[model samples]
Target: MTLRLSSMRKGIRRLAAVDVGTNTVRMLVVSETEEGFRPVIRMRRITGMGKALRETGAIGAPEFAASLDALRDFRKELDRLGVVEYRACGTAALRESSNREEFLAEAARAGIPVGIITAREESRLTWEGISGGGGTGDGTLLMDIGGGSTELIAGPGKRDFVSLPIGVVLLSASFPLSEPPRSWELSNLGHFLAERIEAGTDLWKRRRFRRMVGTAGTFTTLAALERRMRIYRPERIDGVRMTLAKVRRWEKRLAGMTEAARLALPGMEKGRERYIVFGVCQAVAAMERFRIEDLTISDAGLLEGILRGLCGRKGRG
Candidate 1:
């Protein structure tokens, strides 16, 4: 039941959600009405919090500076648009950082409360956000791949979720692969990730979900490449099916390509080229271990989830 804009009444309240992720700072502003939530503004900037944390066990000065600048800009935008209520949440990077209090204080100065969300909260909120938007079945595996950690949720719907710490940025750094990684290297990485995923089999075996849905950059990029699209068309990629065999082939192709060659690939985002191989490898490993033959991609994730919840709350009020 997709709601249309015209159904919304006048004088609808506006809400904003800010996700300070390991690699990106994303903001979404939406209007709430009886019809549904309508997105007004959305933006993302790569801040690389995860990279700095891996090196120093803290959010480095450079990354902190970058995030502050981005947040300052986002503050101006939110004020300019007259957003009534807003919430900012930080994930793995901030949660694990040695100087999170300092960063939080900096964010407070900008009028944004940078709350460090626990892994449990991250999993629960993510499940709420995705499931609220619909399309989930009775038993489905929901996976969100971020820069610092990957979260896996399985249950009846959005109400039940479990999280994992395997993320693309962390995996890329931990598993260093030379351009065109050797077969042995690929095998080693795959085995290591598979073991981690296999640890979740107890829960997976209990529910026995038939479908897998993936959200975030990694799966979206793979969808674009698989379709050979020159531009990222969300309509085309979202809900697209990706098979384990196809992913394995793509991983091999990417693993064999030079950085220059990878940059030239269509639908490949410039900043993401370096880590795509690792992301693909992780996705493939999970799929193989879980016996998941195919996955569906979703552009909607935590941001959408937040918007939906905010709007629903306002509507009920």
Candidate 2:
């Protein structure tokens, strides 16, 4: 077999990063490149950790089993890819889970050490990922809706960010929507989200941003749905623009559909059908609260941010 000259370089490092979120576990394996880094593999498993927490107030047996299986699979991939080092970090789900320690211990047993990151650190890493891609200008607001939390970051100020405790999993569990959610139910959910966003973002409300960027699963899924993508394509979804009117339109349409109907849609992810409506509603509410007309979609999010940090550290060493 012939090897590329780049492979012969000294200190060529391959790294892995795992993001354990409220609803999903995502892992990225990347190898260094002169331009920056190239992804070897990107994988996500919907483990429903946050859903269990939201419904049962802890990590249930089923959720724990699913999460451990995902982590163990990720560990196998890391080893197979010959990753020099890897970091596995947990987010809001783990932070709020009553029995997270047991899960964390089991994750370690599976060869992945899960460290729960603060909301602030999550916001910072998210910012680093978005800004590193080099499209967002100054004062660009970023909205990242996860299963357990939503992070809003605007401007370059050190403290210009807020992480709300509300997310799609929690909202779906809290609000019992009919097959087609009633208008009043949607109204109540909107009010609930608006109040929390308003209370948490007093600083951002007083200011304005050049544009808004949306990241994480919610935004990416919305982009895919908007395009009616039969196959999920990261290259195509990234940098897509979604207007507020269109987002609201999607919210209404989705709200009116049954879970089966939503799942049957071309672009809907398998595990997200039950809660995607809430995510869309949250997006609409956030856009209205921030008075932004449209938002740009960013596929590179927290997972990419984690990989960036690992690459940087490898470079320094």
Give each prediction's root-mean-square deviation over alpha carbons: 4.0, 3.9
- Per-prediction backbone clash count: 1, 0
Question: Which pairs of residues clash in candidate 2, taking residues 3 or more apart in a chain or in different chains?
Answer: none
What's the true lDDT of residue 303 in model 1? 77
lDDT for position 199 in model 2: 89
**What are the per-residue Cα lDDT tens digits for candidate 1 across 217-268?**
8888888888877866656877888777888899989988876788788878
> Lowest-lDDT window of 10 residues in candidate 1?
1-10
For candidate 2, write residues 221-295 as lDDT tens digits: 899998998888788889999789988888888988999999999889899988888888888888888788978
lDDT of candidate 1 at residue 126, scale 0 to 100? 69
**What TM-score would every model get versus the actual structure?**
0.88, 0.93
- In model 2, the runs with Cα more than 4 Å from the true position are 1-12, 133-135, 155-157, 315-317
Off by over 4 Å in 1: 1-12, 133-135, 156-160, 228-233, 314-317
